[model samples]
Target: MIRLSRCAWPGERGAAAGVRRPKAAYNRGMSRNGRIIVAMSGGVDSSVAACLLKEQGYECIGVFLRVGAAPAAATDESGTQSCEVPAAADAGAAPRPRLRHGCCSATDAIDARAVAGRLGIRFYALNFEADFERIIDYFVDEYAAARTPNPCVMCNVHLKFGKLLRYADAMDAEFIATGHYARIRRDAAGNATLARARNLAKDQSYVLFGVQRSALPRCVFPLGEFEDKRHVRALAAGLGLRVHDKPDSQEICFVPDNDYKELLRRRRPEALRAGDIRDTSGRVVGRHEGVANFTIGQRRSLGIALGRPVYVTSLNVVSNTVTIGERDDLLAGGLVAQRVNWLTDPPARGCDVATDIKIRHMHTPAAGRIRRRDDEAVEVRFDEPQSAVTPGQAAVFYQGEDCLGGGWIQEAR
Candidate 1:
């Protein structure tokens, strides 16, 4: 076990290595008040987080999470059998796989440590590789099955909120912090609420919907207050952190190379079986490489060139057919989602309150009416028909910038 503990005193690099100290603000409450651990991914956002915590007079430590199997530096030279030459001399090496985007590796761990050293913070790289594989691997599998699985939501809920919180407690830390661009505030009722970040363009509350109510109190997001990325970069530069100018990771951390198909091919080759491309009436129009490679509203690289343009309307894993239709046929007036998480008490069914709902993170919110469905889903009737209301996508509901709550879209009609 990694013990998964936080660090006390940013400049005090050996606390985790067993150093005790005097009673400063960093050591307040001794056993009660613990250190703050910033999740540093060798990125600028998290680098600044540790800097801000130290400036606030709190004990802080920086940690990078390594989430994949360690890569072979050059190649695997192990031979299966021995020969007269002992196989060492004649054995050919296996070429290493190209490192993909997202998640920390051994290479990134070295960079994170350097950044921590520059910021005068204690640093360590924790191995969360198995947890990431368990969560993110399943996420890719679900998407291959035509379900929109939000790995970040699961990572925030289970790994960050669940496992990391546990790790904080084990280390006797008071709270865990991240570089997320969402604000956390207490409402009049004293309930912790998730709100949009000052930087509207970088707001991340959508993927954080899975955060448990109990975990909200122990979490802090420092970057949420800064409305501009420029300010964040400036803050890091002022602190002289090494990652001050490091490019922001815009893709899902695990799929950094933007090659999801390759990830699926490596993780779940069985799920990549060939499927059919079907019309709305179930008539086979063409053959598809696999349903995993397609998403609703996709048009290009479809490998089919009809005189008129066509778009993927739905995916059926059982039949292994990706159904296609014309643009107008993709519109849907309503949808339903499951596994709803509400920031407030669940909304009243049939309450025609004016609100904005975003079906996907990249999508702009549109006005909608929420009504109760027979099951654990709600009916969202968009003011104007929306396109490609695919199943398995999340539908996040918001009142202005406040995240009201949301659910997974189970159906669109």
Candidate 2:
């Protein structure tokens, strides 16, 4: 299924349209008139991206990265698909209903291949199981250590752009393109820079700051200029692509139900071990089912009564206790971010700079003054106290619409 081309470039109006720019960065990851490997996920956005690139005269190769096998049959006490099953007991006698999560599933790969065929382009499913295993290990380990982890960032850094870039090099491709809602452009100095998408509502620049800056030039984002996701769906539909009507994938690909606590319990049982629920004063106010069940600033669902509402303020791994307190306790004045990855040039140590910080993906940006610390750290002092400055979550720095960089929250105080 493909639509009549829109001719993004002059003289290019169809999938088989002749290419005019031989050295365009969008097609220059290789020697000349370079080939592009579009990372298709069986979703409309990627499908549209591949469709547009092919029409624009690039030699497009559609590749769906195979990250995992089908999850085995299992159910929770409620007979719903649950991540609680232990790793060893997952393979059951009965088969489970297929999950339509919009990730790199086998079904998704097949759909990607079909799109490639419709476009008259080469297609392949690249095995990335080993890469996914490492990402999962890092995800579980971060939780086991009482820190919040952004698996998407790690996956982008290590695989989507890292291993995938290597694969492109081996294939003699000029660039790697994906459906990420971010923009890439060059600066006056001829260095590539990252920016938010034209559609601010769908901007995904936060999760992509870890990308190696050098590789940014070889990255192509075909949908960045579109102001609405509906436009993309319309374009794909106009082209007769089947995924044009597909719903957006909401849950984490690995955790289909978004019940991360269940995944943690299954993979890292220690995180679920019973632990004391203490007050800020070190009083044993209650007991909780391990630190994994709670996160900073979380209220409700916490089965405790102290004559007043209580919120999870902190997690002490050494003491094996979850500290609960009043809502005010969740307010943190500042934070320290570790393992910083600067998309732009980094400031000198102790150099003060003003930037907005986003603690979580959905959080509103908080105005803060940040200063470089060690080689891989930054200190964020917010203009005003911010609540629930969570650890393990990323602290992305932004200067207006530009994505400066970000790092993991090491401590929130």
- The clash tally of candidate 1 reads 5
lDDT of 2 by residue, 1-413 (tens): 34233423323232222322222224333335558879988788898788778766788887777777634534422232312111211111122334567486555666666666667777666666767988888888887888878888998899889988887777777689999888887766657888888878888888898898888888888887778787777665555566667778887788767788888888998778788998999999888887877788888888788788889899988788899988888888899998888888898888889998888887878898999976668999999999999899999999998888998899986
**What TM-score goes with each of the models?**
0.81, 0.85
Which candidate's lDDT is highest?
Answer: 2
> With candidate 1 superimposed using the best TM-score fit, by how many Å does residue 164's alpha carbon deviate from the native?
0.4
RMSD of each: 10.2, 8.8
Candidate 2 residues lying further than 4 Å off, grouped into runs, are 1-31, 70-102, 305-309
Clash totals, every prediction:
5, 5
Q: What is the lDDT, from 0 to 100, of the residue 307 in candidate 1? A: 86
Put down candidate 1 lDDT per residue, 1-413, tens digits, no spaces. 11112323323432222222211212223224547767877677776666666666567766666676543222111211111100111001221232444646444465566656655666655556677888877778787778867777788788888877776766667778888888777655646777888779998888887787666766778778777777676554444444556666656777756778888888877778787888888888888888888889999988887788999998888988899999988999878878887766776675655668888877788898886555657778899999988776788888877888788888887
Worst 10 residues of 1 by lDDT: 82-91
lDDT of 1: 0.69
Candidate 1 clash pair list:
101-256, 101-257, 102-253, 102-256, 337-408
